[model samples]
Target chain A: MKRVKKWAAAITVFITGFIFLIPFYIMFYLSLSSPGDSIAEEWFPRALMVQNFREAWEKASMGRAMVNSLVITVGAVLLLVFCAACGGYGAARVKNKINRMIFYIMVLSMMVPGIINTVPLYIMMRRINGINTYWGMIMLLACQSLPFSVFLYESFIRTMNSSLEEAAIMDGCTRFEAFWRIVFPLLKPITATVVIMQGVGIWNNYAQSVFFLQNQNYHTIPLAISTFFRPMELIIICLPPGRQLVLRLLQWFF
Target chain B: MMAPAAVLFLVFFVLPLCQGVGISMTDWNGFSEEKNFVGFANFIRFFSDKRALHAIQVTVVFGLVSPFLLNVSGLFLALLVDSKRKSRVLLRMIIYLPSIISPLIMGYLWTLILSPRTGVLDQILQRFNPSLSFDWMGVPDKALWLIIMVNVWQFTGGPMMVYLAGLQSIPKDLYESAKIDGAGRMQAFKNITWPLLYPSAKINIFNNIIGSMAVFDIIMAITMGGPGYATESLSIYIYRQSFNGFAGYATAIALIMFLIIAVPIGITMRWMKNKEIEM
Candidate 1:
């Protein structure tokens, strides 16, 4: 009976993993095959070609998009981590009623959707002449992501003991120095988790990029892939029947 | 130090939410020079609109079904791979890979695979059964299901990891004790594992529901609520109303969605808090 259960569990894992991998397998096969070859009955590519990838890279401006995405993600993560670390430390250490009030207000921010502010944020960006700018996009993402960062940091900081701070104080360090020297170092794991979570999220984001940065120069990878479906003269000349159908479906949806 | 973070949240989140509620009560077109308070007329319009109602229903269905299916499947997957198997790490990586792919890219990639004319699925189906041509995105019946399937594929990995963490935390001694007491595998799971996993279940359910409700980019890329309003969700509907020149109506729908999400979330959080205390 135990053996039977183990076999069943193994089979379940295999089946679930296969289902999860199907789309990725299809993507890999399609990316390798020529546009015409992808429509063939063969699941594996008959004639492997790198031309599609090369063309996609150039036409989509993926190289530039990668850099733009990286910059935005890193910038937002830095700002979020720095601010959240300081704020969370303050909230944990400071005993004032004002600090408690501030902490609750930050927690409330997590409930509201960022989309609610889109129109006003757009207008503000325009007034500041920041539309289509990288800084504008970074700042917007930072604002949206700050709430979760502060929440995570605060929870982690509360778990930490205050003896480290006391030791630093006995060593003649100032309060700010004590926090910077004692608390921040211990918070690295939480910061790493925050960076990974928000980094991946910001990197894949499309809405803010599409709405804020209209210029081709500032297009992130998601937005660049979107532009591939736009009116491009090369598409008519190069795309096969199957690829054209895919493009049409995307255009209809978008 | 907390001052800057607090101010940013208030300015961006609290003020905007308050302003949105105000806008929902008014007959504002988002860009008009004149605005007037309509006093719950927008809410009334939201309830009366058939399309909006359909979108709401779709959103609720997706919210419930996708998370339930994903969490169940994820928990099962985690349990399966929890044993000391050589392929466990490989299986885990393969399962989690989809979470890393951008939804827009995934949407585009799936379109290539699901296209009726040249899609791989069509070709495979044709080989086994020649008369199996079906319009996946074009037909209203299959479009929403397809979207749900895509979401499940993308998100199961995250919940699987959470469940894996919970599973690891359960002491092996408990399982050994259950076995010594003549408890079968199923009985042991029922007696020992299930109770211990409740916290993880609560968290996974809450996260998946909230995350799924906010789903926008994938649907925008895949279906756009096509073949009529079959796949229309609240978020998509809100986008249509606001950016698609129905600002007054859109604000109303947004408020309705906010309520729908908030009330259920609040209730669940409260219930989970109680459960946490009991545990």
Candidate 2:
């Protein structure tokens, strides 16, 4: 019975790992398979080809998309970090009702779904002629990402000792100087958490980019990849037999 | 210092939420100048709309299944990697790579793999066993399940990292004590590990649940709630209503979804706070 339980646990772990990996395996295979491989019934690619990556890269305007994604993601992350750092410092040190209210408000802001305001946000963007502009997208992404950033930072701040701030002040540091010089530096671990979490969140975002950025030239990686699906489907509709077999084999192996 | 954050939050977050509510009560077509107060009509329409209701059902199913599976699987992975391991950092990185990719890209990538014909997945299944044939995303019933599978794949990494942090915080002495008491691995896990990991479990479940409830990109990219609305969630329904020209009604649906999620979330927070105290 004990041996059986151990086997069950081991098998569960293995299956979980397999589940995590299967899509990646599929993606590798799909990326390697040629466009004309039309055989619908096989799993492994018979031929290994790098053409799909090249094709996907060029057709998706990957370079420009990467730049756009990077600009938006990095800009948003920096803005969030700066704003949250300041806000977190103020909320941590100030005991006023207003600061408490501000903290709760930030928490509440997180629950508001992005799609709820997307329509008005688009209209607002258009009015400002900010549509498809990197700044506009960055501002929107920053606003959406700020609540969690502030929350994480505020929690970390609450756990910190206040003596550092007192010492900095005794050494003639102003409140702002104390926060910037002492508090901000102390937030490295939490900052790492915030950066990783928000960076990944903003970088991987697609819905906001899709709605706000209509210019084809301003497309992000996600938008570019999405455009590949239909065209690939269209190409698969036209392949001949023997080459199709090669395509199927390519699909399976990669 | 709080002024800037407060102003931004009020303008971008608070006001928009109010506007979202106000928008739901009006008969404003997205681009039109003319508008009228529709009151409860939009809400009435949403509740009665068959397609919208189906989407809500699908969204609820996805929310329930995906969070549970992802959290459990993540905990399992965290436990495996946490126990008696070297190269754990490399293993963690490998597992987390997918979480960094945009869900939209992942969805697009998966659509290719799960394609009915010429998909790598279909080809591989055929190679191993001739009778094992399936169009993973082509069928409506299967499409919803496929979306759930994709979500689990993408999000398990985040929770896994959190769980790893939690596992590392557990003292080595507890396990040693369990072993001295004749406890085997399972016994040690149940007696020592499980009780101590409750806090991590709560946080992981809370984060994933809230996150999963707002799932939009993956569904949009992969199936577009398609093979006929099989994978539609509340967020997708709102997108369809908003962009697809059901403006006020879309806001109404959004409001409903907000309520559905918000009330339960508020309750969960309260419950978890109390549970934390108890622990």
Highest TM-score among the candidates is held by which one? 1
Query: What are the models' TM-scores?
Result: 0.91, 0.89
Give one digit per residue, the lDDT tens place, for model 1 in B221-265. Answer: 677677688998888777767766556667667667777878767
| DockQ (CA atoms), all models | 0.44, 0.40
Off by over 4 Å in 1: A1-7, A230-254, B277-279
Off by over 4 Å in 2: A1-19, A35-48, A230-232, A238-254, B178-188, B277-279
lDDT of 2 by residue, B151-247 (tens): 8887788899888888898889978888888999998888778778778878887777777788898888788888777788888887777887767
lDDT of 1 by residue, A109-198 (tens): 566555556655654566687788877787778778887888888889898899989998999999889888888998999999989888
Each model's lDDT comes to 0.75, 0.75
In terms of lDDT, the poorest run of 10 residues in model 1 chain A is A245-254
